[model samples]
Target: MAITREEVLHVARLARLSMSPAEADKMREQLDNILAYIRQLDRLDTADVVPTSHAVEMGTPFRDDSVHPFEEKEEILKNAPDREGDFFRVPRIIED
Candidate 1:
C-alpha cells in the first residue's frame, strides 16, 4: 500500500497542481501511512458485527424549519446601510 513519488506526481498532475519534488515526497509518505492504517483496519475480524451508520446512539437533533412573517419590517430595515422601499438596496449588477 506504499504510494510512490511517481504516483503522487501523476495524481498532482491530474488535479492540475504545481507541486515541487519536496511536496511530492512529503505527500507520498503521508498517503503511504494512510493506506497502511487502512490495511490495519482491514485485518480486524468483523464476522459478527453489524455495520453502524452512527458511532453513538442518537436522536434527531435538528430543529423544524417553520416559516414566520416579519413582526417589524421597519426594525430590520433601520440597520441597512442602503435600503429601498421595503428591501436592502444593492448595487445594480446586471447591465441594461
Candidate 2:
C-alpha cells in the first residue's frame, strides 16, 4: 500500500500541522515505507503461532500490602507551627 502525498497533507492538516513541501515529501516517503513493511508482515504464516499480550512473560513484582500504627505522634507534632489539642491548627478557610 503506497501512501500518497495528498494523504500525508490531509493527515498533517487534521493534526493542525503546517508542513512545507519538503517536509510533506519526507513524511509521505516514511509513511509509504511503513505501509510497505506492514504489507510484508501480512505475508507471514501465523497459523501455528499463539497470540500473546507482550513479547516477554512477566510476574508481578509488587509486595503484599500491610498497615502498621505510627508510634511517634508527639515527636512529629513538635514541628507544627500551631496545634489545637491533638491536631495541627490552620487559619479558617471556610465561610458560613
Candidate 3:
C-alpha cells in the first residue's frame, strides 16, 4: 500500500503540523514504505498460533508475606527534632 501526499497532508493537518513541500514528500515516501511493510506482514499465516502478551513465558516470583514487629519506636523517635507524645510533630497545614 502506497501513502499519497494528500493523505500525508491530511494527517499533518489533523496533528496541527506545518511542513514544507519537500518535508511532505519525504514523509509520504516514508509512510508508504511503512505501509508496504505492514501489507507484507498481512501475507503471513498465523491462524493456529495462540496470542501472547509477552515474547517469553514467565511467572510471578513472589515470597510468602510475613509480618515482623518493629521494636525500635523509641529509638526512632529519639532522632526527631519535634516529638509529640509517641509521634513526630509538624506544622499544621489545614485551616478551619
What ranges in model 2 sit over 4 Å off?
A: 45-96
Q: Mark the 10 consecutive residues where model 1 has the least summed lDDT.
A: 35-44
Compose the digit string of candidate 2's lDDT tens values, residues 1-96: 498999999999999999999999999999999899888867889888888788888996786688787999999898999999999998889887
lDDT of 3: 0.90
Task: Give candidate 3's root-mean-square deviation (CA, Å).
Answer: 12.3
Q: Alpha carbon lDDT of residue 50, candidate 1?
A: 95
RMSD of each: 8.1, 11.9, 12.3
Looking at candidate 3, the ten consecutive residues that score lowest on lDDT are: 37-46
lDDT (10s digit) by residue, model 1, range 1-96? 577889999989999998888988889999999988888877889889899889897887997899888899899999999987998998889878
Report the error of model 3 at residue 37, Å: 1.4
Screening candidate 1 with a backbone cut-off below 3 angstroms (N, C-alpha, C), the clashing residue pairs are: none
Per-model lDDT: 0.88, 0.90, 0.90
